[model samples]
Target chain A: MFRYIVRRLLQGVLTFFGATFVVYCLMFAGGGDPIQALAGEKPVTAQQRAALTEQFHLDDNFFARYLYFLKDFFTGNLKSYTGRDVFENVGSALQLTGKIALIAIIFTIVVGVTLGIVAALRRGGIFDTSSLILTLVVIGIPSIVLAPLAQYLFGIQWKIFPVNYTFEKPFVSLILPGLVLGTLSLATAMRLTRASFFDNLRADYVRTATSKGLTRFRVVGVHVLRNSLIPIITFLGVELGNLMGGAIITEGVFNIPGIGGQLYKAIGLDDGPTVITFVSLLVVIYIVANLVVDLLYAVLDPRIRYE
Target chain B: MNEHLLEVDNLFIEFHTRDGVSKVINGVSYHLNAGETLAVLGESGSGKSVTAQAIMGILDMPPGKITRGRILYRGRDLLTMSKEERRKVRGEEIAMVFQDALSSLNPVFTVGNQISETLRKRKGMSKADAMKRAVELMDQVKIPGAKERVKDYPHQFSGGMRQRVMIAMSLAMDPKVLIADEPTTALDVTVQAQIMDLLAELRRDLNMAMILITHDLGVVADVADRIAVMYAGRIVEHADVHALYKNPAHPYTKGLLESIPRLDAKGTELATIKGLPPNLLRPPTGCAFHPRCKYAQDICVTTTPPLLDLGGGRTSACHFAKELLDGRI
Candidate 1:
């Protein structure tokens, strides 16, 4: 298992370089003067331009510039186009994003999996039909639409929640944004869970478990749930990276200071350091999530040993 | 015993499908006595397994409704009992080993975990104690290197070994009545005999009453004390194994016997029943076997024959059962 993890990490490093290189090439492909893009109609002196150019290595070749970007990231000297410290921005934003993402994951797994199991066990009943319709409506509405609506309805009209996120009560403040951010994924996970649970409930082994005089709880909880989770785990693992990336719209509406919002502005201003740093971290998240999912598959299914 | 160990009386179960209700088990009734092995012989969809499922209280309720009859275990009607009461009787008093061992055993769990889980839950043994007993049960089923193999999952075992694991799992509860639903159906020919022998030997050693459900006559011919032949969810014939094989009183039973290939009849076209088994959905009028039975007559088409007692513990569900017995049909 240790060897497997080490091998995967090595592969992850290669993937990291490959992904960032492609994104770097695409960002550079935007072309024209980098200083002008950053200045955005502001009057710039030749002296200031020369100083900034020298500082940011605007004259360097593509490979040299890429190396410098990597060096600046590792050495913690990376800065945004606005002269703000990219590392500090990314770090603090990541922490906030992480909190929301964690809450979103919890909301998705708990509500999604529970509704799925209940709906599957009582398939074709009222609850099942309603769950089907509910998930469908939620999945149909993207976070862009839901976030603002939820903010207005629950936050302002109902007064159930604060209109803006407050760090005083992080959990309380993040709950609404988390639910909004996880809406699509939660709906998706519910549908997948329902289908998987339905199929596994009808499996032959479930019958065997029943014949063995196991209680309903053990049968569904331990036996059926173990089998049902394979597909859910796969979906959630792949969605982990998207939770943060997809947080942009949620964070924007709720005024939650997170990397998603930072990444958005950086991309708009063609801020190389901030974009590269944030996106590289997302790449890392994807790699780790995939590895964890793969490892979890082995745990769930004995037939799939790492060896 | 005052009453049989397990008795399934006038049991009727139907499948409510979109295509309409399929009358699966049409008044099927049979019983098992202490230390007796009663083999239920039938083709697919004959409701042999469904009857066993109903007895075990594990039948899929909506699709499979037991509209009539009682499954009495030790003089108590299981159907009438409370869910909690019936659950106590299922694994503790009556256990079942299903066909397709690979699918029947939970895939993700170790063989030991699956076995010990039941021991822990029903028997209420500690994990360590239950696990040790699980290893013993594995060894009892003749699985080599039981202690080491107990940690292995179902997929790790070969077809025969997997079936053995399933048998071991069922035997763990020390159930008085072990209902093996086509246990060897998924195994190879050579392994089929081994599994049947292992089951028979275990039954004798444990002195447990067994209901061996099988399609192949050759598989149960030696192990079975009596054979109950099912046709379209009803028992067409029930008799001692020797008497039924020597002279079957029902045409369906006779047809099944002829289907079995004999060594002396080599190079000749293997005898097969001319037509297919009747479909339970919209089955033929009156006698279900009329379409498939060679001795089917006018009366056979108009009236379903009751399972007539032919004395000497023999019964046949054919209109001309006596004539067939007398060799006059």
Candidate 2:
């Protein structure tokens, strides 16, 4: 297990570098001059441009500049060409986004797994059919549409939660946006779980369990649901990474001061290092989530042994 | 009153399919007494398994339903019992070992846990005592080094070993009627023989009534006390094991006996029944086996044959049952 974790860490590091390289290339492929994007609507003064060029080594080859970026990135000395410290900015943003994402993940898992089990048990019945339709509707409505409606209904009309966010009361502010951010993944998780649980209901083990004279609770809960968890856990892991990456829209709608919001601001302001570092963090999140999932597979299923 | 341990009286089961209601087990009846093994023999789709599932009360409902049946256990009707009441009987009074042990045993659980769990639930034993008993049960089933292998999952065991684990689990509660549905079918020939031996030994030790569901004649020849030859959803013939083998009284049974390839018949072509089992959705108008029976006569195609007693506890569902028994076929 130690060796497996070490192997995964090495792979994650490699993937991080690859992701940073991709982000670097995409900044150039974005078709706007970095100097102009940094300068905003004002006409560029030659002196300012020269200073910026010399400071960032803009005349150097892509490989050389990438190596230079890697050095600064490793030493925790990343600063955007616009002069904002990348670590101080991205780190704080990540903390808030991470918290929201964590909440969303818990919400997704608890509600999704519960609903999934219910739907599977009451298969083809009213609850199953209605939950199916409900999930389809929930998944169909994008988070963009969902955020404002949640803000209005839960915030304005009902006064259940704050309309926007206040960092002082982080948990309270997370309620609405976290739910909006988690909606799609929640539905997806529920559907994946329902499908997996349904398949497991037909598995030979379930029949064997029932034949053992086990109560319905024991058979469905212990035998069927336990076996069905592998797929659901896998989905949760992937969904966590996706939630962290995809929180920008929800953050923007609700004015949550998270990594997503920071990324949004940095992109609008065209801060290259800030945007690159955040996206690279998202990639790292994905890799780490997958690593955790692989480890969890061994924990959930006795048959899976990582040598 | 006859003290039959497990008796199925005119059991009828049907599956509601896309086409229509397909009768799977049609008026099937049989009885098992304590310390006796009854083998329900049939080919695929011949309702052998459906009968087993019905007895266990594990048939998938909606699609499959017991339209008419009374499964009497110790003179009490199991079919009319409430779900909760039936559940208590299951794994305690009437346990079942299914085919494909690999799939039957939960992959996520250790074999020890699976067996011990039943002990804990049905016997109300404590965890430690249940676990210790699980090891003993494993040892009883002839699994070597049961102490060490108890922690292993189902996949860690071989097919034969897994089936043995299933047997150990089923026997954990000391069920009076143990139904092993094609328990040895998934195993290799040698392993099949070994499992049969183990089952027979265990049956004798516990004095439990056993129902061995199988298509293998060789398997039943050694283990079964009585044989019920099922073809298309109904038992075509029933007799004591020795008598059934010596003189099969139905054409279908005769055909089945002849189809077995004997070692002495080196060059002779094997005798096979002519047609497939009748489709239950639109079963043949007459005797279900008549289409495949070589000895089938004109009346056989027009009227379904009832199971008629031929004395000495023998029964055959054929118009020419007497003729066949008299060696006139």
Candidate 3:
């Protein structure tokens, strides 16, 4: 197991460098003046431009500059275009996005799994039909459309929740947007769960378990649920990175101060340092999520030993 | 001792499909006494496995419905029992070993966990106690290195070994009746014999009544005390094993016997019943097997023969049963 984990981490490190290199290449491909402050409203003097150029080694070739950026990035000396520490800016934004994603994911798993099981148990019945329709409608509604409507109905009209996020009650502010953010994924997970549960419920082993005098609850819970989770877990694992990407839209709609929000600003301004660090973080998230899922497979199924 | 440990009286099983309700088991009846092995012989779709499923109360409902039947266990009608009561009787009093051992056992669980689950749930044994008993049951089933192999999952075991694990699981509660539905059908020829030998030894050792559902006459000849031959969802003939083989009273049974390859008749075309088994969707008007029976007569085409009791514990559902017995057909 240790060897397996080490191998996965090694692969992840290689992917991290490759992903960052691609992003760097894309940034350089634009062929814009690298030393210019794209965000600054003030006109720059020649002396200021020359000073910035010398400070950043903008005159060097692409590979030389990339190597210099890599050295600075590794040594934690990389800075944003606005002269702020890139690590400090991205780190704080990351923490907020992490919180929202964590809550949304938890909500997704609970509601999706419960509804999925219920739908499977009542297959071809009223509950199953309704669940399918409800999930379809939720999946159909884009968060862009859902966010403003939710703000109107629940925030402005009903006055139940704050119109925008507030720092005083961080968790309270997250509830509505987190649920909104989780809706699409919840519906997707529900469908996957229902499919996998239906398949496992029909398996011969389930019949064997029931024949052994197990109660209906035990039969479904222990036998069917464990068997059905393989597909569900795999889906969730792959969705982790997408969840963060999705948070960009959700945080924007709710005006939440998170990494997704920072990412939006960075893209609008085309800040190379901020975009590079933020995107690299997403790549890391994707690689780590896959590793976790692979490791979980061994834990969930004894037949899949690491060896 | 109870004369009949388990009995199915005039059972009628039906399958509701997209087309219509198809009667699968038409008034089939059989019984098993304590320590007796009754082999239910039939081709596919003859409802042999369905009969066993009905007995175990594990029939997939919706598609399968027991339109009419009474499953009696120790003189109590199990059909009338509550779901909870039936559950109590299922693994504790009567257990079943299904066909395709690999698919029947849960893939993710260890063989020991699967066996011990019933011991823990039905028998209310402690975890440690259940584990110990599971190891012992594995050993009893003649699985070599039981203690070490208990930790292995079902996929790790070979086909024959997996069947042995299933047998051990069913025997966990020391059930009075064990319904083995085509248990050896998924194994190789040599493995089939070994499994049958293991089943026979287990039956004798446990003093358990068994319903051996099989399509092979050769398989039943060695282990079964009595044979019930079914055709078109009904028992066409039933008698002591020796008597049925020596003098098959029903023409269908006679046809089945002749179809078996004999070493004495080498190089000859193997005898085969001319037509296919009757489609249960719309069975023939009179005897369902008439189209496939050479001895089928005029009356056989107009009326379904009742299962008549011929003294000496023999029953045959063919009108020409007596003629066949008298060598007149």
Candidate 4:
């Protein structure tokens, strides 16, 4: 088990490097000049341009420039293209992004799994049919469309929530945005849970469980649900990475300062280093989430621990 | 009659599906008494397992509806009982060990947890007590290092050990009647003998009535006192194991006995009953086995045979049962 975990750690590190490097290269080669973005609406003076170009090593070869960025990145001295510290800016964005994503994950696990089990048990019944339709609709509506509409209905019309996201009273302030951020994944989790539950329900062990005289609740809830969990957990782990990456639009609508917003702004302004840093962090989050998923599999399935 | 621990009477079960109603178990009847073993022997799809499932009250419902039946346990009709009442009878009064231990036991849980949790839930024993009982039960079933192995999952054990764990789980409740449905069917030949030995030993020690359901005639030869030979969801013959094997009154039973390979009669073409069992969805008009019977006649093609008493508590569902028993044909 120890060796297995060590191997996972090594794999995670390699994937992190491989993914981050690819993203960094893509951002560097992307069209639009960060120097021009930084200069804003002002007309460029030759002296100003030359000074800015030399300071940022505009003449350096692609490989040499990447090494310089890597040096700053490794040393924790990396700066945004606008001459701001990348870590400080990205760190604050990460905090808000983490909050919304955490809530979204919690909602998906709690509500999504419950509905999935219900729909599977009473398949073809009212709850099942409605949940099926609801999930399809939820998956259809992208965050760009859902964010503002939810804000209008619950925030402005019903006055049940704040129009914009607030850090305080997050249960109320962040709930709307959190749900908006989670809608797509929430639907996927529901469908995955439902399908998985259906598969396990008819398994021979379930009949043995019923033969054991276990109550319907215990048979379905404990025996069937425990076995059904592996797929849902896998989906949730992968979805966590996606939630962090995709929260940008929901955060944008809510005007919540998060990695999504930071990444978006960096992209629009052609700030290569900032974009690379935020996206790399998201990659790191993905690696860690997958590592955690492997560990969880060991818990849920004893057969895994032997390897 | 009331001395019988459990009984299934005229039980007719059919699967109602969109395609058609498949008659799975038609007028199957049998009973069990304490401290005895009854073997329900048949090939696959002969409704032996379905009969057991019906008695256990675990048959899948919407698809599996009992058209008519009375499962009497100690003078009470199990079929007429309320859901809760029937539940109380299951596991506590009667428990089952399914055919394939690998699939029958829950994969994610430890074998001990599966057994112990039952004691905790149904018996209301505390965790420690239930766990202690689980280990003891495992040890009782002759599983080595029961204490340590109790923490292991189903996949961790060999096929034989997994079946032992399943038997142990069923015996947890000290059920009056234990139904082992093809328990050793999935085991190795060497393992099959060992499992059968263990089951027989356990049955004797517990004085528990056991229903051993299997397709292997050899499996029930020594362990079973009474054997019910079924074909196409109906018992073609029922008798004492020794008597039935020596002199089968029904042609189907005689054919089944002949089909078993013999070392004493070597170099002879192994006898096989011609034709497959009829499809239950649209079974043959008369005796379900008539199409496959060498003795099939005009009457058999048009009429189903009812169980005819042949004295000495034996019965055979064949028109020529008397002639066959008298060896006149």
DockQ scores for all the models shown?
0.86, 0.85, 0.78, 0.82
Which candidate should be chosen as best, given DockQ against the real structure?
1
Task: Superpose all Cα atoms of candidate 1 onto the true structure and report the RMSD in Å to 1 decimal.
Answer: 1.7
**Which prediction has more favorable DockQ, 2 or 4?**
2
Question: Which runs in model 1 stand beyond 4 Å of their true positions?
Answer: A166-171
* Tens-digit lDDT track of model 4 for A115-207: 898899998999999999999999898878899999999999999989997757655788889987777688998999999999999999999
lDDT of each residue in A166-228, candidate 3, tens digit only: 888787777778777777799999999999999999999998998999999899989999999
Question: Model 2, B1-329: lDDT tens per residue?
Answer: 77798899999999999999999999999999989999999999999999999889899998998989798999989888999999999999999999999999999999999999988876789999999999999999999999999999999999999999999999988899899999988999999999999999999999999999999898889889999999889999999999999999988888888999999999999988887887899999889887777787899999999898999999999999999899876
Candidate 4 TM-score, true structure as reference: 0.97
State the weakest 10-residue window (summed lDDT) of model 1 chain A: A239-248
C-alpha positional error of residue A232 in candidate 1 after TM-score superposition, expressed in Å: 1.9
Per-model CA lDDT versus the true structure: 0.90, 0.89, 0.88, 0.89
Candidate 4, residues B1-329, lDDT tens digits: the string is 34578888899999998889999999998888888999998989999998998889998898899999899999899989999898888898999999899999999999989999789998899999999999999999999999999999999999999999999999998998999999998999999999999999999999999999998888899999999989888988999999999999999889888989999989999999998888899999888988888888998999999999988989999988999988999
What digit string (tens of lDDT, one per residue) describes model 1 on residues A1-307?
8899999999999999999999899889977676787888998899999999899988889999999999888899887777888888877888889888888888899898888888999999999999899989998888889999999999999989888888787778888998887777888999999999999999999999999999989999999999998889988888877786647788989888798888887888888888888899989888998899999888878788775
**Per model, how much of the real contact set is kept?**
0.88, 0.88, 0.84, 0.77
lDDT computed for candidate 2: 0.89
Relative to the true interface, what fraction of contacts does candidate 2 keep?
0.88
The candidate, 2 or 4, that scores higher on lDDT is 2
- The alpha-carbon deviation from the true structure for residue B213 of candidate 2, after best TM-score superposition, in angstroms, is 0.4
Candidate 3 clash total?
0
What DockQ does predicted model 3 obtain? Answer: 0.78
